[model samples]
Target: MRPIGIVSILREQTPAPDRSFNFLMAAAGNNTGNLLFTHAVWEHLPGPKERIGFQFDPDKVNATCRAVVFPAANWFGAHVDLADFADRVERLDVPVTMIGLGAQDHDFTGKVDVPEGTLRFVRAVAERSRSISVRGTYTRDILARHGFRDVTVTGCPSLYQPLQPDAERRLLENAKSTLGPTLLHSTRFSARYRAFVDTPSIHLDLYRYAYRTRSDLLFQSELEEISLLVEAAKKPDIDDALIATLLDLYGAASWEELQAYLHNSARVFFDIPAWTQAMTGYGRAYGTRLHATIMALNSGVPALLVHHDSRTREVCEFADLPSLKASRAALDEDAISKSITRADFGKFLKTRGRNQETYRAFLADNGLL
Candidate 1:
């Protein structure tokens, strides 16, 4: 178990590097797999091996480490000049593998914003890397469209640290039946999309909302605001109910009286596991937020998605997971009802599982596994 040095972004507050380095090192490749990434990703991965971090010097790395792994798009400070970074790394004369996070390629409507200076950066990235891995097929297609015929692989990090089917399945099996059809929303709702809601049939904006989820996902929030001034408000099915119930899972309360009980539920709450346990308590979920959808799926609970932007859509599409238009029009009672009633629990699992395996195959093919 020779040590490997992983270069990734972190909060600058990690206690110390642990098994994650080895975990990443193996899954990414012989050269790619030995490194760990704390990029725009999960906080931790556990392994039984000790690996060095930046705290160690280059000489120590060259002498004892196996190879390096980097997903330079850590979503951090300063724009990445891909060419320059590639040059700097190549100059080290050490083996390298790159995880290309092209997650920003497709919007909810399946369109993408070709960010300024991005193509050039990717070319530079292509020019420098020994190998490349894209997050999804959509991105892989986009890269192909751009003439990036380099050795690009398709692997989704959301499915990178794979979970067991049994583990996720039991979560759904054990979920309180009352929590069915989990509706998940993030605090990520934007004000711009709100403007579109005020003018429904006449004004069309959802297909171009860019970063807003289809209006249907936020039914609870919408209804709450609508209820403040209306006679009879709309009711949510499993899709719409997930948002409220998830909040309920977090002590928000199932009903008003339960809301009061949760006010002091602090007396019974711990920080971390409570959140994990709460997350595990969903049977089926429809989410507008990426991680919410991710956790639900990883937990084996059937999850449907509402896309607010390209990132969400690309991720789900890459994983071959399903997403419904979160457009305001789609959020109406009829559409929402149809989406919920037509919810294909079997398809949700089958599709994402196939995608997960595809990602795994990329890893194996790339020598990461």
Candidate 2:
């Protein structure tokens, strides 16, 4: 059977000849939650194994095979440049079906006023596709205003696909009963983007509080520290506090020493199952990394999301994820307890089921599966 083409970042066959360059690219791709989620969706697509693979090259897409599926994420965001991307997607002559697509607002405002480039890309997708699967009501409403009503709210495919109806029930039961002291904290501390924002104080606070409380915090997203450590050695102009915070967080005295510790310890996880499995024994997980928290939730660990941006808040609100705004998330015992205690996984599970059904139906309607 001819494979259903996925419009995603497929692994490059011919990697850069430079080993360090290829290593960084691989890390960047794996560190990105969307890419991981995309791989999961492709892995679980309802079709024969031989009938699905990434077709990012537009010229390769033709009517001889199955329809193209562009899986979900915060694709429509303020920071993204979509003009060339839209043109490339449009070049595909075959049918396109977008699943769990979302728009991101950095300021957390619900209202979305996208630029022409974004509008052009959206219009192109709308024109080519039978229906667009959106992340939540927020995206649905946003796209509706933009004159694209052929949209369905399917939530994130990563949260729903490989669906387990009993997963949430099990997680909730665990939360109420044998919840432990080990906490899996998924952080978003990227030194590559450190200059953009102040590293959301709540994340730092969580690291400190979780460590001091002796709750055994297993931190994810160590690539940023790795990046900083590498950069600090090459250039002396790097921020002193940035270096200090990383050292303090990881308990490393120097960059050279931290690099060795990181390599030896193997702290960063690039694979989804590896990351998800690591969260299993944890009592409760909290993190600003939205997908990491979702992975925890999907894996039946009682989890809470510390939302840092509009994309995070949208998913939390849309899916009823137990969440606190990073701006207001106080690291007090009462506050933490309240956030965890009030998490309604039962409600979220129902929503997840419905969204999964809606998404599958969207694919079926588009002749995808």
Candidate 3:
């Protein structure tokens, strides 16, 4: 099959790097989703070779690529302009672009009222006659709502992509810190459950750049993100191994000191596990990271997603998981705790497997299965 160029619209993640790319790499037993899909599509290509291009930068994409894959532009924070790029890609005529993440990034770099560059992105994509797919069913719905016809809800590329042997083990095994019942908070960690937006009262330019991205004098919005979670990690119910992670990501006197801090913060018996394993450990989790929730459900963790963005709900409901809406004061911790404990992991797994099969069938029907 011919090698396809993958234009990754990846933006800077919160201070801590999000690992969607990591999962994609795993999909092909390679290092990125671009490679995985390229390899997968290679099988159906009426070509003579068996390799794929590995360009991660959208600007530097090779001209020979007949198609490109983008997880979802909306979730990438919508920080860059793509009108020119889209025009260039459109010139390819036969180029196939995949939009995986849900609608465009809501606010530019986490800030509201800021101009959105992705709206142009959507317009460019809409001009196309054919497309690959997106991650969440909501994406498909939204596209349809927006009058887009050549799109489909293809599960997040991360689920179909392959990964390295022991990658999960390495991600978790390398982690050995002390954590209490701490929520793994990021800027958008639980954005859906609670609108953790920068309060308008906070006037630090870095803290609130008038939109999604924020930074500040003492701590960038990113660092505060780390601080809040680290603070929560001190609970007795938290995992002991994740403490060090907090310390490093946030800042601590030491692992021991971090543990002491968490103890003081409101300790919960939090056994932080791997991204996927956390679902298994918690028996249930409320998360904003789409893949984390997906992994949790796949791991049999009865996860109630805090749909920070559309993808979470789109993916969750697509899998038949009863995801809840995001509201700062909406969730009752007591109620959530009870439901999680009572959730039948086995039943959830069966449901997920059925969804998986149906999704595979969809892919196959599209010649991508």
> Best candidate per lDDT, number?
2
Sort by lDDT, best first: what order? Answer: 2, 1, 3
Any runs in candidate 1 off by more than 4 Å, and if so which? 9-64, 71-84, 103-130, 151-155, 164-183, 187-275, 328-341
The lowest-lDDT stretch of 10 consecutive residues in candidate 1 is: 264-273
Q: Best candidate, TM-score-wise?
A: 2
Query: Poorest 10 consecutive residues of model 3 by lDDT?
Result: 211-220
RMSD from true fold, candidate 1:
11.9
The C-alpha lDDT values of all candidates are 0.43, 0.65, 0.39
Q: List RMSD in Å for every model shown.
A: 11.9, 4.7, 11.7
RMSD of 3: 11.7
Model 2 global lDDT (CA atoms, 0 to 1): 0.65
Ordered from best to worst TM-score, the candidate numbers read 2, 1, 3
lDDT of 1 by residue, 252-357 (tens): 3344543333232211111223333554544555546555455555655555577655555666665655566556335332454455445554565566577556
TM-score to true structure, per model: 0.55, 0.80, 0.51
Model 2 CA deviation exceeding 4 Å by range: 10-30, 48-55, 111-113, 163-166, 184-189, 192-200, 210-222, 226-242, 245-266, 332-338
TM-score (C-alpha) between model 2 and the true structure: 0.80
Which pairs in model 2 have colliding backbones?
3-51
Clashes of each: 21, 1, 50
- Residue-level lDDT of model 2, residues 100-213, one tens digit each, is 788887776767667778778778878788878887777888788888898877777777645334666677787665446545364554544543234436666665565455
